[model samples]
Target: MDWGLVLVLLLMGAFGGFSAGLLGIGGGMILVPFITMIFSARGFAPEVIVHMAIATSLGTILFTSMSSVRAHHLHGAVRWRIVALLSPGILLGSWIGPWIGKQMSSTVLALFFGLFISFSATQMLLGKKPSGGRELPGTVGMFAAGGLIGLLAGLVGAGGGFISIPFMGWCNVKIHNAVATSAALGFPIALAGTLSNIFYGWGVADLPPYSLGFIYLPALAVIATASVLFAPLGARTAHRLPVATLKKVFAVVLYCLAAYMLWKAFH
Candidate 1:
């Protein structure tokens, strides 16, 4: 094993896990860009690097999301009713997303990821609130909303918080509840997205060793181990911290990452 690479992944996991707990974002927004950088630097085929990064990021979320959500659940923050309502659609959309991604050229996919992250960052920076009196939609409406959230998240390897939190907030759900529910929802998004990526990427040419479809298993292992440990700490901190400040700082970081991805796409 490359010890240097392990160190990098460990650090990434620690930070990503903390973010997952704090933001209910599953850390994929952070992981995808960094993983892409690492893979690109290591001379992995450009065509596969972004996909592998995306898939592996989701794979790590499989562990981190659980740890994060458990801590949030302990805090009585999760809205389980919303999770149940949204899951069926999330599953279907998540699976379809990676399949669609598999058909796109790497450059186009990278462009999409970059643009979407930029949009998410803008949403964060603005910190918009919904008008009062709006309520969450009924089952059919929620399912459709969930599908949209899942699709966008899978395409970009996110946990869907960027969309779901805002949607819930617009419907007058409490912020903490929205965050916790988004964390609970991450598991299903990651599960379907990971499986779909694996299926679509199976037997692709020029893939690096130790790949399970598009996922780099070694990175997944290292990231997941470190991320799970840090996630609870982040969840606890989320209850105390001024989340607005954190979101603004994180937004800046995301903008930078988006810029990097855009540069990579062009090159």
Candidate 2:
């Protein structure tokens, strides 16, 4: 293991974790592209680097989410009832997402990832608040949204927070509460996506050492540990900071990163 690589991984983990804690994001939106770039620069197989990056990101978020959710829960912002309503669909979607991802060509997957990031960036930039409504989404809408979120999570190895938070807000949940609940959703998405990645990549030959399916264990370990320590700090910061301003800045950063990833995907 190169010390440089380890250090880079740790820095990425801290950045990603801190972003999650402060922004109510899943961290994959930032982490995946960053990891892909690092792996590419390190001479990892171009064909597999994005997949591995996404999978490893999802695995890392499993731990990161725990810390984030705990902090949000402490603030009394999580909506457990909503989490219960959407969980089954999210779980099912997570299982199916990786299977779909496995069948796509690497180039196609890269393109898909680029597009997804672009969309997330756009959402962040717009920062449109939902019109207030207190009624929860109907059962059908809840399942449909959860399934969609799950599918995206599995395919992209994200925590689905970028999509989930806004959707919850539109469904009439308060923004802070929506973010908090979305953090809880990360757990199932990560678990299901990790399992799917393992099964989908199982027995593939010539993989990098210590890889479990698409995930790199060393990266996962480094990222997960550092993220867990920082996530609480981020959550606390969110409560104290001007979140609207922070979100705008974060959106700009995401747009820049997304543009870079798209360039990498094509060139």
By lDDT, the best candidate is 1
Q: What is the number of backbone collisions in each predicted candidate, taken in the order shown?
A: 0, 0
| Candidate 2 local distance difference test against the native | 0.85
lDDT of every model, 2 decimals = 0.92, 0.85
Question: Model 2, residue 159: displacement in angstroms?
Answer: 0.9
- Can you give the lDDT of residue 150 in candidate 1? 87
TM-score of 1: 0.99
List the pairs of residues colliding in candidate 2. none
Question: For residues 1-267, what per-residue lDDT tens digits would candidate 1 score against the true structure?
Answer: 599999999999999999989988889999999999999989999889888999999899889989999999999999999999999999999999898888887899899999999999999899898899998899999899989988988888889999999999999998888988999999999999999999999999999999999999999999999999998988889899998889999999999999998998999
Off by over 4 Å in 2: none
Please list the residue runs of candidate 1 whose C-alpha ends up more than 4 Å from where it truly belongs after superposition. none
